[model samples]
Target chain A: MKPLLDLSVYLVLGPQDCPGQDPVDIATAAATSGASVIQLRDKRGTTREQVQLAQRLMTALEPLNVPLIVNDRIDVALAVNADGVHVGQEDMDASKVRELIGPDKLLGLSVSTQSELDAADLEACDYLGIGACFPTISKDDAAQVGMQNFRHLTEQATLPVVGIGGISLANAAQVISAGADGVAVISAICGAPDVSAATKELSSIVAARKDLG
Target chain B: MKPLLDLSVYLVLGPQDCPGQDPVDIATAAATSGASVIQLRDKRGTTREQVQLAQRLMTALEPLNVPLIVNDRIDVALAVNADGVHVGQEDMDASKVRELIGPDKLLGLSVSTQSELDAADLEACDYLGIGACFPTISKDDAAQVGMQNFRHLTEQATLPVVGIGGISLANAAQVISAGADGVAVISAICGAPDVSAATKELSSIVAARKDLG
Candidate 1:
């Protein structure tokens, strides 16, 4: 059986965004403060370093029962024994990732437009990371998916949706209100002065909005 | 211009091999002791972790001017601005990795037999990781490519060849004598009590044999 995914306040950590902080510390803080899922999203680093960090993060997260998701790098995911992986349009296709990761692990795909959603094999993915709900510095190339489109895409997707791209406490509720099951942020948490506080604030907003439904 | 790849004494690091050793420390020790290329091979961990690790390894390797190669993760390679990527036959096709990594970065492909070599897009690859010269615990599924087949594959390849799978200082000379430009090893180095000494020993053997040519 596939494992359950907690999409609420999903935090995607980027080393570039964290600067002085260790990824493990940031992840632990986020998880402790109620970030439902933590996706490690490094675009730089050797696979060995990645695995080392993942092992460290896993040690911190396991006690909290927060699932650790890897972004791309199925080999790393398999090596670290992560809960799942998230892939972008340029990364391996969702179906192939599903085949490699198998039925048990969670697989999330990024989709910014209706066409991408149409092309994606929803059955292969446990959830959809849909957006740049707004323009995002987190990903310079991310095509903007305005509130209307974000809502439309969320409604259209058969899988659960986590709104990504430029998401913050100020705008996160809007995404949840627009029908996103959760909001995924990078800098909002990683770049925060206090990662735990940032995560807590976002989690409360998501919870409040989710409760309204 | 793209950075030159030493290929000689190529080291592939696996998380399983280094229980307590930091990959960066191992890589640094290996590079300092004359391992020409370092390939980070992790079958687990998130992409973020991999990139972070790669960045650290890159920092350790940069001053020594050693190239850092990622195993089976073009996205991580691209994100970390790694020197190149190595892909197995079961992973992304070499042509696609070539296109994504572009003209400058090195791209290596793994081939176990002549058929696999013939099927590969040679123009897209800078080198071939030809294996398993002997049965290997590093990868349980690796098909054995005894010395004769290893020689045959090396002779058939147009690109530089690195004989992998069960390579060690004891047998590494045999692979170099079989026309391999280098040897790629996992446990042989990472599992060593002294990674630098292991790398130095392997480098000396590979060098002496290559000198015979």
Candidate 2:
């Protein structure tokens, strides 16, 4: 059985944030530095490219024992034997993804509102990507969940929570302190001048806040 | 109002197949050369990148009057205001996508068997992408529908049928003859040494066969 994931400093990489960079390399840098998990979030590229990238990332991450999660495309995740997949409200639901990926793989759901959270089959997901904690360019339509709502939502969530959207070292601790088990970032680590350093800082911050609890 | 998609000579572009080519350029070439509809099937890349590519394809295809259909990512389709989204069984269901994209946009569902076809809420789909009429390297998991199954399925399908998976200039006419209104191709167009020429040839073959009907 695959080990349960540590959601701390989860790195979400997309081509938009890491233009001209190999996704595997960017993920390797972050995973090696401190990111606990890596989620490949490509909304464009063929199944072949996605599978190839996932395979490369799996090769790189498996030795580190870091889990590679594919976002939105379960077929790509399965094709490359990735550790898991993450889906948003607009993507396939968690139950269906669970059935497809099976029980061994981690399944993540993106939740923004209390009603959505209430309706979610919590048993189907390993973690919840609770997002838009602040306005984010990562997702233009992501509704901001703000600190208060984020805290409330996390407090009630049975599944682990990884705060996403606009997360960075500067505010990651705040999100963790607000009750998220970790912070999921896109541009913060992906577009940073030094990805490893950025990941380390975010990891330390999330760790410190979690330690405080 | 977006013009009703011709659904003839539909081109499906994937980053893996295109290699170094820009999706917009390939889509433009295909559209101008006689492709009737363009489906951007990027199984990888961030939502931002997908939306940007869809926007570029929309810009390239709009004047030519070819509809741009996004594969799987409803958020990206909505973000760029593209013509529609195409989803497979493992992806989001057509009904949910229809609810999200609304009645104004096109919605396509991929069906490989009679049971899948029966389970499908046909009213929710604007068209059906039916196939694997032969073995297809494009989707490793696609079950070959063969000409007989393709003909039977298309005969019963109330929605327009676009045969996909392994469809090529050599076999496209056969699929059209089998009852598909069109053929959705990936490698046959995107990987060709000359995309426009390839698209033109396939379009002519499909048109000629379609004309016979």
Candidate 3:
């Protein structure tokens, strides 16, 4: 088993999601302010950009002792020696990804459906992200897995769980209260006018929930 | 060794390049009209879209006997059981891609510079894509390797060579005459008003050049 991550305020940002600001700067700010984990999910850039930016991100986050997770593209994750890789149902199977990524690197699998959650090989990934806890703009097709389903799935997950998709400051506490280790958010922090402040607020919320528990 | 492909008109199309038309429709038309190979280079769609579309493309082209090569994303290629995969200098290392895809699947590596060509592990891939034979739009960053340099690389290359970038009916024969087996094109066939006519014309040019040789 991999070392457990704090999972609180897991910020998922990319070139496509960052808009006008540089992703590195956004990630740097989020990391320093309290984001425990960072995931690079660039859906719009070229393969070169993905690899290059990920290298930069690894360097940026290394000193902070925070882990950088690559979304979907294991090539970039392996090339950059990132902390982990997160895959959806459509990407390479968790078992194959684990075999290729090997034992040391962290692996995260997203489970949006009960069958998918039920069928996920327990040995493949270090953690599970269950969502769309609410409607999400990032993945418009994601079936709304409502808070009730999110709680149910989290209860059944063998590994640590995080709430993904459409999570924000307004309701991030709800995700933790429902028994997840953290909330994986995109726009709430990446699109925030003040990224650092947004991250601090979100992290405190999850930290507080864990403290309460 | 992977079987040497009939390199005549290699059509590189993707959801991003096909514009108003469905990528499948465009690929089918080009394949039937004489495109010897088809590579899906989608830098735009989601991972699910990439895999699902590539699967549909494989079924569509299997009967026509054209190979479907996925660009950059090896996971999609492996998931869909694609005939092959094409990678650029920035994607996964050719040797590593070869290692994962194994011996049977065709592997193509793109070399835009002399250093990349010189360092390329010749035994790793079945073929190489060399170019921006002219100023090409598909990848604006591709270095413009004029015909002189393109021919030099092709001559030095141990594997079959295909000219990629800015190739069209007007300039494809030049690529063939330059010693490359075929022209790997994107906009010329995918963006053409008549996809079938464009493919037939481009394929004939390559065939004619080989005949003259």
Query: Every model's Cα RMSD, please?
Result: 15.3, 13.0, 4.7
Model 2 TM-score on a 0 to 1 scale:
0.56
Error of 1 at A194 (Å): 1.8
lDDT of 3 by residue, A1-213 (tens): 454587888989898887778899999999999999999988676677787899999999999988999999877787687899999987777887787678988899999889999899879888999998978998766788999988999999989998998999999989999989999999999888899999999988899988997
Q: In candidate 1, what are the lDDT values of residues B1-213, reduced to their tens digit?
A: 678967888989856667877889888998999899999987675555666788898888989999999888776676667898999876766776676667999999999988898899999999999999988998887999789988988998999999999998779889999999999998888888778788889888888998998
As for TM-score, the candidate ahead, 1 or 3, is: 3
Model 2, position A155, has a per-residue lDDT of 96
lDDT winner: 3
Worst 10 residues of 3 chain A by lDDT: A1-10
Q: What clash pairs does model 2 have?
A: A42-B44, A42-B45, A43-B45, A44-B44, A45-B42, A45-B43
Instruction: Write down the worst ten-residue block by lDDT for model 3 chain B.
Output: B1-10
**All candidates in order of DockQ, best leading:** 3, 1, 2
In model 1, the runs with Cα more than 4 Å from the true position are B1-213
Question: Chain A TM-score of each model, in the order shown?
Answer: 0.97, 0.97, 0.97
Docking class of 1: incorrect
Best by TM-score: 3
TM-score of 3: 0.75
What digit string (tens of lDDT, one per residue) describes model 1 on residues A68-169?
999877766776678999999877767767777779999999999889999999999899999999878987779998999888989988889999999988
User: Candidate 3, residue A47: CA error in Å?
Assistant: 1.7
